[model samples]
Target: MTQTSATPLPPPEERRRLREAASLTQAQVAAQVGASRETVRAWENGRTTPRGHRKEAYAQLLSSLAAQTAAQEAVGEAEVTWRQQSTRPLTPAQAFDALYAFCAPALVRQTYLLTGRRELARESVERAFQFAWQRWPEVARDRDPAGWVRATAYDFALSPWHRFRPRYRHPEPPPADASDRALLDVLLKLPPPQRRALLLYDGVGLDLPETAAESEASTPATARRLLHARAAVADRLPALSDPTELHRRLAELASAERLRAAKPPTVRDSSERRARFWTRAAIAFTVTLIGTTALTLRTAPTRYEPPVPPGQTVLGVPPKVAPGPLSEREVELRRKLREETASGPVRLVPETR
Candidate 1:
């Protein structure tokens, strides 16, 4: 007689474990199984199971995922131990190095999750780090510098200018398992605000308040968004029904995403670009001043004496003229006066003689 193996776990438990191991969301498995995500959830919750051929196919998929996850986990455990040992405290410069090493990859992964574009995600993270490096003192003093950078990266990824540029797509690394891809697909379907809330709370491990602050939403609003997101996720991946497991899996997926690519180099210091900007601004101001002055001088009126009228003189001198002859009345009156004077003077002259 042939030896037989023990029966496998119940479908619900098996489904949950396999989904976690594969890092797939229920939505992903549902797509593969040609069933609704709710149906998959029901199967995992022991509310129902696939009948006949579907059940057999689902089991096979779960078994395959289990085998793959086991092998990957063995390697992951070793790597994680090494990473944990390597992370330690250091001096300021070394601390920045440590921070970059610790945070940049994760930031990039977070950006990628938000934008779904690899190159844009990388650029966003690099730009955020560049800003961080430029303002190291302030960032270092903050309680959550990494969160600050992550927030910056998120904003950068969502910039509208991205729509105008030709998309230069960098192929993403294949998902560690179907579950990861599925979850990411679902996340990508979410509105940016909801996606950000979920990532901050679940993926980045922020509390509700912090997540709300990051998403620029009120606490109640953020909570509502998270509630909706969680329900959606649970519908797809029944394994994530457990809040603890949901957080754990989200954190694991975030870590795996970080490992997908190397931490992009800390962006080159922007000091040179800043210096150039100031230099250009100064030159522009000086040029503007000089140009305005020259324009004023060129356009200004010149001062000089105005021309005088033809007969006018600065000294008030009159023009020379000839005198007219005496009138007839004046001549007649002078003759009469002469006669009278002659008559009267006759006696006086005789006496005088």
Candidate 2:
């Protein structure tokens, strides 16, 4: 007797949860895997089973989305826990305190890696948190608040606004060892996307697909970037030849960044600062309003001259004139036309007797 084995399938709930966690719709997953929406829904609902290539594609896509979802969920849980710690009304100050204490260091480190400027990194992280404080209610409800802040901080660090800001004379200290410096040089030389992919994948401990998502690129594109980054690094740094050594080096770099991030400048109480900011803003607004009002009054037309007393016209006003007769030249032209019409050649009519 011949026996056939059946492939085990993931649970429907698991499939649905992974899709939702990745913030993807059934249609999106179907498009990615070249399957129909109904087919994907059927698979997720356990109404049907994927076969051969479809099964493999489903498994791969599901696994990748699952990893990304897991990373985001981990951050989400941290945010939720932080929020749950206090039962009292959450104020901006209180919210900032919680987020800063929990997420600031990590964000700073991430920015530092991105920009390679310590002061810029610090400023970027602080500004991002400040924005978070301003929008605490919305941010607090975010699925991954820490990730949101990190992304904000990264964008701020790379913003062109920094060009106008005062430059720091002193640079951040370099890596202690030659190998570290070489590694940094190699990383810095890579294109932004590739570098970000490398850092997120190797340094931040995110999986390949998660790194792709974070970099805002497709998995295949991210994989290509990672390959290019690794090839460049391998060419420059012989020590990174071994996979174990490469991981160790990346871990060391991550550790160093964390250490640097830990000692950020003390954040002042935002309550007083916020109060002062609003007070200044209000005063400026009031002054501007007064100035605008005064200017309008000065520039406004004099009050309506009491409508010119009924019949009596104003001194400078001109009287209305009715249309006059045609000019002399026009009259002469009209007379000539009448004469020409009366003097026109005449034909005699012959009458039969």
TM-score of each: 0.51, 0.52
Instruction: Report the error of model 2 at residue 108, Å.
Output: 2.9
Candidate 2 deviant stretches above 4 angstroms: 1-96, 169-171, 217-221, 241-245, 257-279, 282-286, 303-353
Model 2 alpha-carbon miss at residue 203, Å: 1.3
Q: Can you write out model 1's per-residue Cα lDDT over 49-162, one digit (the tens) per residue? A: 687556666766777888898889889998998888777545666766778788876777777777766678878887777777778889999998888888888988888677
**Per-residue CA lDDT of candidate 2, range 123-233, in tens?**
888777767766778889988788777767766877756767668444567777776677777877788778778777777777987777667799999999988888898
lDDT of each: 0.76, 0.75
Number of clashing pairs per prediction, in order: 6, 0
Error of 1 at 228 (Å): 2.1
Relative to the unseen true structure, what is the Cα RMSD of model 2? 24.8
